[model samples]
Target: MNHSSDLISGAATAATGTQTTSPEPPPRRRLSRPERERSIVEGAVKFFAEVGFDGDTRELTRRLNVTQSLLFKYFPNKASLVERVYQEVYVGRWNSYWEEIVADRRTSLQERLVRLYTDYAKTALTWDWVRLFMFSGLRGEAINQRYLGFLRSRILEPVAIELRAELGLPGPDRVPLNIQEIELVWGINARIFYFGQRRWIFNVPLESSVEELVQLTIEHFIAGANVLVPRIVQAQIDAAPAHAD
Candidate 1:
């Protein structure tokens, strides 16, 4: 009856009757570029969800019913495809929201950052590909670099700049943001959002529906950040993400 329960019901329905991976390929045979990409990406998510970033490409392609060479032509090599998948497929449509928020100027900085993270949490629960993104973050450097790009550009820089102006942050907020702190906060909210998405089947408790959770989370951050004297009000910046604590 609650939002999480409703989301759980809807996701369960949407996940049914649809084959996640394409049919297997021919024995000892290669595949076309598009087919290889399709097979590898689709199968890769399964591997990512289970085995993570270092998941075997051989097994991945084979499951797609294609030869390794077929997969190679499309990806060139295994490591490279990991980068592509992280950026292109794993993040996918999520990046569009990224560009808009980072560039949009119609909302306050506080609104922008909260909107960004809340939207992120909501999408994580709903987007099937997010499983791959979440799992991949644990692998190592290749994934770490991808993570860094996201933090620096999408998360940190925007927050650093906007927080400075919005809160008139006078201390460390002006200097370069700390990576460790950024990663910590990023992980915390990500964990919460992910739990909300899975809705207890994964064994994590959900406190609210995805939509309500996002709204409450946004408000919490705004209230916490507004403690700075005379919260700077900018009505032109697009709503997105941030935090120091």
Candidate 2:
């Protein structure tokens, strides 16, 4: 009978003599033009979200397991790739229905606002969305500027107009939104936005659920607006220079 030590020595000798090779990985499938571009865009969104606009293309290509030349074939440059990421992440997530929700006067202003913010949180409060936006702002990238302009024009301004209507104040066409009025609206938006910041950036755990907080925020805004907006409009009217009758 072979001893255990003798059997182990024989197995070791056999293993050393026979070189084992790993099985070859399956071949990568060639992507169609659209598929390839889409893959690059999707990968770039995650990459920039992780490392920001300062992240280099070489690293991005490495992360994507694609050649730099292939990346350029689709995007031509890093700026173009960043732009595509902005479009995909920022613009793509925007809902046209948000505009409708803000403009829907059939619903009470408080209800509409709560609904809109609740919907907005679904897209805007995520890790990718919040992180990418903060990174872009830190880098002083144009993404923040562009998106803010869009927000002011589309959402904030419209909400201000609706607030005016709710308070029986003249529409913006009659008396354009004063800076105070705009900033008041912005205050509410800022409060909601900070909830995301505390969550994603500062890594703070919020006790209240997003829905609960949003409803609370909207309620507070409506309560304040009901009191303050009239005074704001009245002050604007008072401050206006009297024209000769």
Candidate 3:
């Protein structure tokens, strides 16, 4: 009896069966140029959000399972990549209708503000958005400066103009929006923005719903603005030196 040879043959047969049954991994698909760029930007957004602007591109590529050369092929440099992320996270999410909403005279200023903040929070209060903004600010990146400039011009300045109209104060043409007036609008935005910071960055539990909090904040601002804005403008007027005839 050739028992040893029989055993060797059975082992070989088992190995062959295992190899035949094993599934081969599917081949990687080559993405189109636009598709590749889009993926890199998307991955960078998430990577920067998790680890801030200082996150290494090598680690990012490693996480994405792509070569670093591929990333640079889409983005010339890390700065360009970060810029794309800023556009995607901040500018891309901006609703042009918000400008119209602020300018819409039919809606009361308070309601308009409430709607603006509520909608703004919904769009800008995500984990990626909030964290990336804070990280950029902390790093003194241009992302924060650029976005805040847009906010000041598009939103804060317009809101200040609207508040002047609401309170019967002189328009920007008559009395340019002073820092105090601008800060009043900024305060409202800052409060709403801080809510996002609390929820997303700090990982804190909010005491109330976003809708309730936004409404409450806007209501309080309206109440105070009615009294304070008039007083502030009057104070500014009084502080001005009288011209001698």
Candidate 4:
């Protein structure tokens, strides 16, 4: 036989004799129940943000190297898992200090507003927060409504009261806010909220840091409020029907 044929015959004889095989990959290290559960939750945060609440968990489990039973053991159901996500992303993330700092009487309203927005933007303008917020809004989720109501009661109403004070107008309790004035505060808030969307969602590059953005927003709002609030107040006053003809 030729050298090549002899070599092949020798290899076949060796294969037949030993039945050569490749080693299997090492098994994954086992995680404790708590560690595994926490791992799943964190993974869910990223997964849900990417694919939204409607996205399948099957792929999530596959990526997590876990069985569906294991995920369900910790979360019970997909809805319960989503509730935990809401708790972590929204309910738990809220800083009551935002309302407290804005309500602090020592600082000028402009200073207070700037501080509040700057502090808020630091946490609230992030990818997880912004994307989850947009996702909830698009899904018609109740958490978003609850968050809006909280803002209306806590941040916006307080800011509105301060704006009235700035203009020497009566307090909301004493003079009640018109829809227009309430929406003016909403407009300011919407601008800041949308600024995050522009930066994070639309991939707009902002030259300003969060602090600068907050300051710029406050400056424009204060200047515009100084000019327009007076006019708005006057319009309300002028439109008030004269004493019974």
Candidate 5:
């Protein structure tokens, strides 16, 4: 069995390409899944981490010391493996975290967002394949749509409704935000995802570490949301005077 060095190179190279120094994933926890599935994803993550999303399946099998059929028995195809690995690496823990945060209202919405950023930051530092899919995710429409829902239901929806009631504001009215507000929050999230994940993918400047990015995002959102809410309420009140009978 022989795997090309480019096995983890293709998609990464396709994105920004050609780096001399590369890092490897730390020993992944065995808690990943059943042995067969865990082995498949861990290998897949290594390939994506080393080569990138476009890494060749043929090389993957060679590295796995398995036939294509054997590989497919677990993952089906390259894209399917990428999806499975993505879920195992990034999505699984995150969804579990979602369950915990969703039930807790004692924490502020901003706190929940920061917790998420911090979690991903830690994962990016230790998990190689996770960082790859994060970068690659920006390109997939289906992933993007699902990602939006993940944000809306798990974080934004609960927070928005709570904030609206707390401030004595009409629910999602001109007082503060609408559906578009979720996209604004997504922009902040994109920054956290971009720089953290981009570090391994493009070897971009880590002018700041992962935790710093998460902290900065949390701080900025707190400061900005405060300012944004008032302006929205003012706009509504100013318009109210004209509408009065």
Candidate 6:
């Protein structure tokens, strides 16, 4: 992941009457403002992911082979450029229609969960996305939090509702999510996220293909949910303070 951006050539020194090291210059290219801005941001994503958020903008410009001033013209600063990278990578990649797909009652709950994850893993399980996500997490970046919020509101909540429905329990709109139910769904969701981390970040060998993994995970999840939800709902009911008749 390291790049030539941080390298300094130790060739010569004039004061010592000895050769001084000069880093090799980046290749020159005549790109328009929009084109060059795009290029800088693209390079910055890879550069930041490799060296991290603390990585120098000078190195980033070197990687882009552009003058620092030119990069500033578009981004003003590294933070601004990082914002665009977040927007491009995290926000832009979101499929708005995923909610609809997940909420489609025509599909069985098991089928919906599997399909939702299959679509998610296809796009979000890449090395760049996972690495950037981990990097942002370490930096306490809000973008990753926002993405998680999106997942809860769109993906996780819907699955919870569907899970309850599949077991003939009341929806969240009625009984709402009990602690046990929430934990149940979070456990399932966490396993799916870890699957991506294991595959991409850890480079673990997966015995199941993406499709097989999704199907297997959801099937097991649904099996557990069917048995757990009723017991959880009863526990919640018993825990409620009874009113005097």
| Ranked candidates, highest TM-score first | 2, 3, 6, 4, 5, 1
Question: Model 3: per-residue lDDT, tens digit, 1-245?
Answer: 87999999889989787544668899989989988888888999999999999999999999899998888888879999998998898999999988989999998999999888898888888899989999999999999889999999999999989998988898878666788878888888889888999998888989999999999999998888898888877877788788899
Q: What TM-score quantifies how close candidate 1 is to the native fold?
A: 0.60
Model 5 over residues 1-245: C-alpha lDDT tens digits?
44566765676786886767768879855443377677777788788777767678989889976678878877767778877866766576564665466456687766766776687556545547345655466556254456567767776666656555545667655444565455556666567667755566677667876777788887887677666765665576676646556
Q: Would you list the C-alpha lDDT of every candidate in the order shown?
A: 0.59, 0.89, 0.89, 0.83, 0.66, 0.78
Provide the TM-score for each candidate, comma-separated: 0.60, 0.88, 0.88, 0.79, 0.66, 0.81
The stretch of ten residues in a row with the least summed lDDT in candidate 4 is 170-179
Query: Model 5 Cα RMSD, Å?
Result: 15.5
TM-score of 2: 0.88
How many collisions between residues are there in candidate 5? 6
- By TM-score, the better pick of 4 and 5 is 4
Q: Evaluate residue 57 in candidate 6 and report its C-alpha lDDT on the 0 to 100 scale.
A: 92
In candidate 4, stretches whose alpha carbon ends up further than 4 angstroms from where it belongs are 1-34, 230-245
Per-residue lDDT for 1-245 in model 4, tens only? 47999899889988889665799999988888888888988899888888777779899899888899989999889889988888887778889999998789897888998999988887788888888888888887776888788889888878877888878986766456777777877876788888789887899977778788788889888888778776777777777777886
Query: Could you list the CA RMSD of all candidates, in the order they appear?
Result: 16.4, 3.6, 4.4, 5.6, 15.5, 11.3
- Displacement of residue 219 (Cα, Å) in model 6 is 1.3
Worst ten-residue run, lDDT, model 1?
229-238
How high a TM-score does candidate 6 get?
0.81
